[model samples]
Target: MKRLLILPLLALSLIACEKDDDSTTNDPGNNGNSNPSALTNNMISVGTDSTSLNKYSAYVATDVNTNKTYFDIFIYKDDVLDRKQYMLLHLTEIPTASKTLNWQSGANAPGAIKADEFVIYPKVNDKRWFGVYSVSGYETTGTMQATVNNGKLTLSYEDIELADEFISVNVTERKKCSGKLTFLLSDLQGLTTTAQTLDLVAE
Candidate 1:
């Protein structure tokens, strides 16, 4: 499979996806709820199609300066996710603790999460290019985990194997799509040289 869609530059046209490394952008004041408190039952199921993640907004960008932090995470129902109807989860290197990254397919190095770079633009009063879609943790083989304790962040993945390079614009072919993306890390508001975004950014 040719999962070469690193987008116009990790997200958007082909949908944003940027994962950089040499690590060390973990902020949120270093976890343990410095101010965390808002989102409750957060959810993100790709294939079986589940939705819960609410109006949490966070867009921290860095690439113009470079401590290399391009973390983005935004859920939607009204607007925000690059113009509405979205589910952007772009994180590269910013998890202060608890780790696990092992994607395949067209693997975008730097903490890996390449290909289409984890995107989606489901409809809720539409906006994001009308009908958008993506979920490339390398596209096939998966395991992009992050579970920072205390400050309660929980991004996850599993069997992911839907093909065509794990999907870039394929809508829904459902072969595999795991989930579990809770929130906290003092409510992420963090990246780049560059990566992705969501209702969760910490690249």
Candidate 2:
């Protein structure tokens, strides 16, 4: 009788131990790091429009080595995302005298420009609204761009060129500007939908 009773007790103890192990493995919250397999790729956001042009801004950062760069997109009516970008370049790579490139209000093809009412502020404090002599112009190397949505503004060569670069925005205040609610990029690697409000203007 003693031997038989001991055998059952041992089996019950083994079952209890197995249950504990299974519980731990199924608890996803216990894992401190996010599971990479569940993440979306190349995530981006189409920002909300503001009442004042100076009130609208965004910043994007990417790793050139990773071949994943940030392209600033403008959101138009009817859920259309404009790919004609007002991009920020790393000015260090630009050569002297500047060159021409493409220019658009957003991330898609560009339309006509109301040249008289345009301004490009390289730094946030600079108050010089240069005219768009050429829609597609080049700038000095290593010059980054920031875009603002304040009606009409001038654009130059250094303002609209592409380089082998990547960017991330410092969105910390433009959260409640106006327009539509913020949405994250459903594509791209290691990106998120959690809204960030930063003011990074493009050249």
Candidate 3:
């Protein structure tokens, strides 16, 4: 009877050791190559007028290897006038200091407007402002200014519009976008918000 008891005890010990080994190997936090995922958030607000609908989505991400930051904002609007549209604003190499970036047509502005720097896609022609789908005649005109002060990030846009009335806008009337987004860098670092930036433009 003593021998039978000893055999069962030995088998239990072996099983426990196997489980411990598996747990250590499968732990995500222990993996050296694991990178943090993007954070994402959604917000809804009432439009200035009763007939308007406003929805905004924001995302923020930082690459652990390069420490580069990327941000994106999507705006959706609807109204009684059948004005259903979407606007996208993406930024790369975003300055942590107070600076303004702009993109225009047929002008050479260093660090201001480049395919790898900033993009504002208004869905004017069902094409993106950057990358392979970039429109030929369509041009993006906007200002993206950002400032990092007091451990907070302040982002603002002014009169950001897409020019090319025929194929891009698809409507006789033009649309102008302007807004402000402010949040604390500490909150983002803590992963307090679920907002994660998406890479709409590949550069």
Best model number under TM-score: 3
The C-alpha stretches of model 3 lying farther than 4 A from their native spots are 1-70, 73-87, 104-116, 120-138, 163-171, 186-203
For model 1 the local lDDT of residue 123 reads: 25
By lDDT rank, best first, the candidates go: 1, 3, 2
The candidate scoring highest on lDDT is: 1
For every model shown, what is its TM-score relative to the native structure? 0.24, 0.17, 0.40
Provide the RMSD of all predictions against the true structure, rounded to 1 decimal. 18.1, 26.3, 22.0
**Poorest 10 consecutive residues by lDDT, candidate 2:** 22-31
TM-score of 1: 0.24
- Candidate 3 per-residue C-alpha lDDT over 47-123 given as tens digits, one digit per residue, 9 for 90 to 100: 11111124334445442334554454444453212223444455544465667665434322222334434555443
lDDT values, one for every candidate: 0.40, 0.20, 0.36
Instruction: Give the per-residue lDDT digits (tens) of candidate 2, residues 76-128.
Output: 22211221222211111111222322222221111121112111212111111
lDDT of 3: 0.36
